[model samples]
Target: MTIAARMDRLPVTRRHRVATVAIGLGLFFDLYEIFLAGVLGSVLEKHFHLGKSELALLLASAFLGMFVGAVAFGRIADRLGRRRAFLLSLGTYSLFSLLAAFSTGPVMLVVMRFLAGLGIGAEPPVSDTYLGDLLPPKHRGRYTAWAYTLAFLGVPAAGFLGRWLVPEAPLGFDGWRWMFVLGALGSLIVFALRTRLPESPRWLAAVGREREAEEIVARFERDAGELPEPVENPVVPAESGRLRELFVPPYRRRTAMMAVFHVLQTMGYYGFGTLAPIVLVAKGFPVVQSLLFTALTYLGYPIGSAVSLPLVERVERKFLVLGSAVLMAVFGIAFGLASASWLIVACGFLYTTASNLFSNAFHIYQAEIFPTALRGTATSGTYALSRLASGVLPFVLLPLLNSAGAGVLFTVVAAAMVLVVVDVGLFGPRTTGRVLEAVNSRVGATTDQEAR
Candidate 1:
């Protein structure tokens, strides 16, 4: 079948929506664990008698583990199949989170958190690939945005839980430990819910499980009351997929652009995310006040995602990315400079909202840019680079913050945002309503040769 015809065959159904929600919940918990670490930093310091540098190092360690997990599991997802890979990553992270609660020292905590980060990193790209491939083009932007928006809800959920748990130390357990425990328990719930979910038809087809793929697609069609047109019989090649495919010809430039954008974007993202509360405190707020302010800032994420849902489908993907980056740069600087608590909060709200908007766009953009054959692997590999950059920032940037100031930090972050705007806006092709294969075909012979 022609690419256009295949694109037209996409089924929009209740099953797809159900799958998106289930997969999104799993992602929410995954992100919850990552962000919760920052919330518990002070408690960890008090419990372990850790200095600032030591605490920062512990956070960095988890991100390093995430880098490994994203690259490793991404390949595994592409090769072993998405369902198995998703289940394995989820199980691995949840188990490690539970284990982390029993840590007697920083060493054990760091080790466990690192292992958990590996599991956490594997999920987003894999889930993005799975969701993007399944949804019809017409709803792709909104659905993708909703999925990421749901995942980010975990941020405020962690904040709310931390606000309560950090003070009480329920059951004589460390409040931070409770966070890990709750995360593990939540993962169990996600695992149970996911068992009812089915595999991606696109993935099955890519791997040559045609009958299974057809059956899955048929189920979705039944749910939607409209069937997508079937593609020609897929040819199963010998090579499953490889990391090297990301760097060939047409994809090479795009890959490089995305890598640079992710790196710079994350530097700004982590810079602000890791230090938002600190900035709030530096503005003369008390600890509790700062935490509350930070929580309020994060509360804007879900709201931002929801607000963007209506426009995501209407706007060009690249435009959304560029606009958000510019907004983050502006609000980030404003957030750093504001002296009044109310003004600071307003700036922070805008910054975080813009951050979520850009983030949602990028998640969908990255997954849709690659072919089914290489989607998981490429997304994982590229995203891993961002994680690696983020891992280093805490160690390097935090010290700079101590010596310099919020102004310097925000300025640097703003510069990074500018770079992302330029890279994505200039180079990113319009994938707004195109079929996955059609998007891939535009990537050209270089990517085709690499796919072989």
Candidate 2:
């Protein structure tokens, strides 16, 4: 059996669960940091006496760092190894975030945020790819979705932490500083735990380190049962894929699909993410009420992810994505048009739920679609576009929301959602339950073929 077969054939085990949780926790910090800015903004605004422009610059800083990190570390992960990339990124975050706590001015904070954002940007693609490489095909879709579900917990965790800490300066330290310290400390813990995980055997073999791959597989087989006898096939050498191949046949389509998908997806995510609370305030919800309700609304993120967990394996991944996209357009429009408080809240919940489901589907899908030799690069490259789009959306989406009203703003979001439906519904292939090599082979015959 090939490495893909052995990987797919292995049963879920404690070791696999540990790896997922550790990696997922690393991603958890990333999301926490993402939402942290929103929650911490008021306090930060006061401490620095920041103007609107400076605050905007501060919020946008991390995404800029993320863009650089995603592109740079992604290529590094592909060139070096997933494990190394993972450690390097988490380490970068831990060190810089702790440094950020000592920041004296807005300029320093923004720089630190951007630097920390690099790790934040680099982690998800690597985590998703690493999980895909580790989990067998049978368990891959649902399990990875669960990992992301756990990651989404960071949203609520940040909100809750902000609520508790922001009002109180603990031990004479400001709440914001404590938040940074907590985030930094959490990342370091995950980095330490990640040391236990084995490198992706698929990546190991792809890199011409078959001995290392086989050693890891031996440990897996002890719990997963022995893999079927090996079958011979031509090896695809490490570093075989060229960067220019991104614009070629199989990859070109995926690149285009992912790039467009991310543009809309990021706009939708950050648009709603940033705008929803503001919309409430505009609609006359009090500050405390909006904060409370916003927290309530965000409950949908993790819950929605969990709701889709069972469906990951049962549903066709693309169809699930298409279905969620359809709902996002419909409900987002409804949310914008909602005048009643309950109606707006209900629609907000539904929209968030659908968004989480959509995020999970694409996270699993993007990692699944590409060949291992190019997976990190392809996934992260498009992911960087989303980061860029997200960073820019606040500028465009807020203005549209303020001037044109929610209806016009969501109409634009709905239109973007249409791109997702069109791309994945028409062009995307089935990935659930299929072997990674087989899926890659179907696309470009770029991967080593699956055993007969």
Candidate 3:
């Protein structure tokens, strides 16, 4: 039995849950910072007296930095190893977030935000890749969703914190600045915790360190107790994870699909998540009311992720992406059309829920599509497109929001979701219940075609 097969056959264990929680804790800060941009939008605007372009610049800075971070750190994770990459990314983000809290002006704040984004950007794909490497195949999707359930809590945490603190100064320091300080402190704590985690056994094996891989898997087996007999899975020697490998055959199609998907999906995901407070303010709600409503709506992120736990493994991943995209489109449009407070909140909540469902599905799908050698690089490289689009989104959507109404903005959002449905539904391969090596072994043919 190969190491991969042994890993696949192991029962869910204490070590697995602990690792999931540790990675999820890091993701919590990543999301808290991601959503903080929307939560603090109006407050920052008022404080800095930002014009629309300047405001857009502030909104886009972190995403732009994330674009670079995702691409760079993903490759770094592939080269240096997942454990080291995790520490580096978190430390970079934490240090810069603290700096962001002390910014003297809009320019300074934007610079700090961008620097922080470099760390934030690498987390999702790396988290997905790491969790994919850690968990057994049977419960892989569920545990991944479980980690995200914890991570998504950060969304509502950001919203609630903004509601509480953004409205006024606290203890003579700006409330918003305090938010950054808290994120930095929390991230630093998680960084310390992550240091204790072992490297991915699968990653170690692929890198030709079989002894280390065996030791880690042996520990997991001992911790798990009474695992089933291991199945036979041949160890396909790992390919050199060259950058251009992503541009070749079976992977090339996947890379293209993900790139297009990421670029468009941001319009539906971050389109509302990162801009909702500002949109509510545009619709005549007071700034505080907007933050309150946005916070309420943000509650769906964790809830929606929880919703995916049962469905992520039961349903086909591609179908989940399709269904969630449709829901996002419908609910997004409804959110714009809603005139009553109850309806607005309802639509917003549903939209956020569906978007998170979409998030979990795709995150799992992307991580599973590649082999271990390229998992980090491929996941991060394609995922970077979303960050690029998100960076560009403010310039496009904010201007449109200012000139047109929320209805038009959401119409554009709906259009993006429609394309997402097309992209994933038509092109995505089925991955449920399969081991990672089996999914991406053939060079020219995809797992979907091979299965067929």
Q: Give one clash count per candidate, in the order shown.
A: 2, 2, 0
Q: What is the TM-score of each candidate against the true structure?
A: 0.93, 0.93, 0.98
- Clashes, model 2: 2
Stretches of model 2 off by over 4 angstroms after superposition: 226-239, 442-452
Model 3 stretches astray by more than 4 angstroms: 234-237, 443-447, 450-452
lDDT of 1 by residue, 1-452 (tens): 53324434666567777878988899899888878777776567678999878878887877888899999998888888787778888998999999999999999999998999888889988888878777877788888788778888998888778777777778798777888999999998998888887877777777788788777765665665655456543332333466676677557777887788878888777677767876665567776677777788888778778778987888877789889899999999888778888888888888888888888888888987777878888888889988899888888777766778777878888998998888887677777776666567644433434543
Off by over 4 Å in 1: 1-8, 226-240, 443-452
Candidate with best TM-score: 3
Cα-based lDDT at residue 118, candidate 3: 97
Q: Which scores higher on TM-score, 2 or 3?
A: 3
Point out the higher-scoring one by lDDT: 1 or 3. 3
The whole-model lDDT of each prediction reads 0.79, 0.81, 0.91
The whole-model C-alpha lDDT of candidate 2 against the native structure comes to 0.81
Instruction: Estimate, for each residue in 278-340, the C-alpha lDDT of model 2 and write its tens digit.
Output: 667656776446656666667778988998899989998888899998898999999889888
